[model samples]
Target: MEFGYHHSSFATHDDRSPAAALVDRAQRLEDDGFEWLSLMDHLWQLPFHGHRDEAFVECYSGLSAVAAVTDEITLSALVTCVHYRNPVYLAKVVSSLDALSEGRAVLGIGAGWYEDEYDAMDMEFPPADERIRQLRDAIQLCETVWTEDSPASYDGEYYDVDDLYLNPKPDDIPVLVGGGGEQLTLRLTAEYADWWNLPGVTPEEYDHKLSVLREHCENAGRDYDEIETTVTIPTIIRDDTDAAHEVYEDLLEETDEDTTPRDEFRGLIGTPAEVAAGIEEYQALDVDRFQIGVPKNDPETIDRFVDDVMGEF
Candidate 1:
């Protein structure tokens, strides 16, 4: 399976600036056989992952800068929140990035979550059902904007556009929908997305979702094999499993309690060999790609994972 690096943390030392650091990391990832580099699209960090008040970078702008620095790795947001920007405007942003990257751009998107971010930004946070509806409309609108000639008009339940004109359109830009709602989300994925991202689900759960997705694809009269399957999980890799657990513990908040076998962890946290085994389990379920969110800005874990785990796969 191809490996993708998700930039979930923003940590920089005195030796380099954040922008320089990202460039270096991006180059290293490309050299190390990572196929894609995705950045978190949220305006503020999520509390479950990091401090909400911590440093955060805008997604598309950062992607443009990264496109200038790296040539091989495809650049995208881990999953852009659909509610944050107008559907047509998002198409414009992604098309601009695709042009900048010379067609090395993919759009990973989802219905908006993290109500706190929306409230903080004074943006409306609709109910989950409504949000998903908007996501569906946005996907349709994006396709219209990207593929159709300009001066178009689209009227959907949630998103309506008049005389929508998009120039410098991307050449068949791929959309990867991120979510695993067995009903609406999976149906939408089967109907609209080029890729389906399952975040933090176990191998068994992933297998079940694949089944559900296939059923949706059949109902929609679409080929299930056409949609690439990807899974994103936080990975902590070290030379020793115990050392990795120590790092995991350190990363936990004060109120969090440690559990045996790291039950508190939702993703792989162990030595390179152990992590490779975990990936093999997922591979057995027919997962096509893995996007790992390595906490902090620790480059050593990424290097170790590539040298040890990725080589085995």
Candidate 2:
């Protein structure tokens, strides 16, 4: 399976500027054989990651900076909230990044979550059903902007564009939808998404979700194999098993208690061989990619993962 790096925290860069640390990590990830890199799209840090006061960068802007620094690694937000920006504007932003990066951009989007962020930003957090509908509209609108000729018009339930002209169209940016809602989300993924991602799920859960997705694809009259599947797992790797577990415990101590429950959290915390075995479990289920989230952007863990586990696949 292809491996990607997902950056979720900017709070642990000791003496270096956040930008410097990000650039350094991006370059290293690219050099170390990561196929892609993603940043969490959050205005406030997620509770499990840290306190809301911790440093967090805007998603697209951070992606733009990384684009300038790396030549090869594909860049994306782990999942942009559909309600944060108008679809027309988002299409332009992503298209611009694709042009600047010479065609290495993927639009990973989802229905907005994290109610605390909404309240803090003074944006309305609509109900789940409405957000999911908006998510579909946003996807359709963006696709129209990218594929339709100039002066395109789309009338979506939550977004509308009239005679809009999007210049410098992207070189076919893939749409990756994140979330695993059994009903609407999976149906939408079958209908529109080129890639579907669900994080923090055990192998059994992933299998069940895949079955639901396949059923949705059938009902939608779409080819199930057309969509790529990805999973994100919080990872901590060390040469020693005990050391890896120690680091995992330290990470738990540093983060909020609202994190995924221990029994449900499908994180990888062990030696290279053990982590590789965990990855193989997903690989066996036909997952196309694995997005590894290293706690606090730990460089040593990232390096060990690349030097050891990656080669095992």
Candidate 3:
């Protein structure tokens, strides 16, 4: 059970410059034994997680800054929306990051969601099926740009590249498709992705989704074991179980109750020992990695997690 730090919010660092805070946090995470690091790709904080007016940094830019400061920790967006940027440009951006990081880049992508963001940005928010198809097209375009030689041409339904020349090509950027849509998204994962991630799911839900992915792999004539499986677990750790619960309650108070239901705040929310036990449950399921989302990036909680729970694993 390898651990990754999922940097989901910047609200707590409002007093300081985001660059200073992000660099400091990235360095600390690498020193603290986190093998992977991810950031949320959003124009604004998600309604369920924080207030809309909170600080939000662009995804790839944050990863680029972290890349300059850290070594060894794999960096990525938890999931970049397909519609956010042109596929060709996105390929170049990620390739640049891979080159700068010396090949520690993973493209974690998904179909566009958050209709409110779409409206705010004046971007088209297509239907679910169309968005999934667009996501597939985007993945195909990126793969061609990253792998094939220069003067590559790809004809995808949503995007097309004619005589595209991508220089300084990256060496195999792993594609981690995010989402648990039983039909289209799982099929896309089986057909193309090197990794599949589903965040905020229960153990039972994860089991069911894994089974679906296996079926999709079989249908697609792909090996299920070839794809790495990762889950983002929203975690809160404290010295004692009661203290952890108090922290969880405080987080709930900050979040929008209408968007975030109480039950949705599921994951390792307890003392180090209790959190360690919960992690073992997922480890028993053969999960390849756990992306721990420590809300607000609390220093004490992060230290306790790395020192106590992660050490036990």
Candidate 4:
């Protein structure tokens, strides 16, 4: 399986800056054995475990900073929200970032979630139905901007742009989408997304989603296996703590839904053997990529993942 490190960028009250710790994690992800690194995109800071707004980093700026320091691992937004920005500008930004990283970038997109984030920031968070349409249009726009030399024009209910030009197109950059919505989302993913990421979902759910995706692909006249399957699992690997299993269990209780995201991954609990066994279970569901998150950003957890779980894999 292709392995990647995923973390929420948060500030700690005790000491040091969020940027330093984030860089530390990215550097270690490369130093150890991860193929890629991803960070979530958000406008307003949400409530973390304890501190609400102290430690979160701006998504685009931090990602650029990470690209500046790392060369071994690919960098990407875990999933950029569709309703978050203008499609044309974001297309340019994504293409530029891919070029800057020498083609080591993935564009992961999603229909927007978290209404509070939009409401508080005074951005329009359209209803789910409209958001799906918006996502489709955004993908169309991004693809056009990347592949076309002449000005691109698009007309949709949610998006209408004319004669927009982008230069220095990226080479072989992939667009990933996160969702399993059977109607628009999965169909669009089958049609466009290079990777389909399922977050904090059970192997059964993942299998079900993949089934739906396959059906969508069939309907769309696309190959079922063309879009790769990825898993973003909330993980905790404790090197030498009696708290190994409990950490995963308690993390859900402590962190809020908006911040922690995808609360269903509590199965990351248990001993290394048990977690490894669980990983195998997930692998059985045909996961192409696994982006596992470390609890508390502990170096030992990273070591445990590389030494115990990934080593066995």
Residue runs of model 1 more than 4 Å from their true location after superposition: 254-261
Per-residue alpha-carbon lDDT of candidate 2 for residues 44-148, written as tens digits (9 for 90 to 100): 777677766777788888889999989999999989998778788999999999998999999999998888878878999998889999999999999998999
Candidate 1 minimal-lDDT segment of 10 residues: 252-261
Residue ranges of candidate 3 with Cα displaced over 4 Å: 13-15, 258-265
Model 2 CA lDDT for position 275: 91
How high is each candidate's TM-score? 0.94, 0.96, 0.96, 0.90
Provide backbone clash counts, one per model: 0, 0, 0, 1
Candidate 4 lDDT over 117-212, as tens digits, reads 887889887778889888888888788777877577777766777888787878777989987788878888888889888777777888898989
Runs in model 4 lying further than 4 Å from the true structure: 11-14, 45-51, 239-242, 249-254, 257-265
Worst 10 residues of 3 by lDDT: 256-265
**Each model's C-alpha lDDT?**
0.83, 0.87, 0.87, 0.76
Write the residue-wise lDDT of candidate 3 on 1-313 in tens digits.
Answer: 7889899877554577766798888998899889999998889888668778877889999999999999899999889989889999999999999998999999999997889889998988999999999999999999998888998889989899988889899978999999999989999999999999999888888999999999999999999999999999888898777788778777756766543344564678888888888888788889999889887776678888988888787
- 1 or 2: which has the higher lDDT? 2
**Model 1, residue pairs in steric clash:** none
The TM-score, computed over Cα atoms with residue i paired to residue i, of candidate 1 is 0.94
For candidate 1, the per-residue lDDT at 55 reads: 65
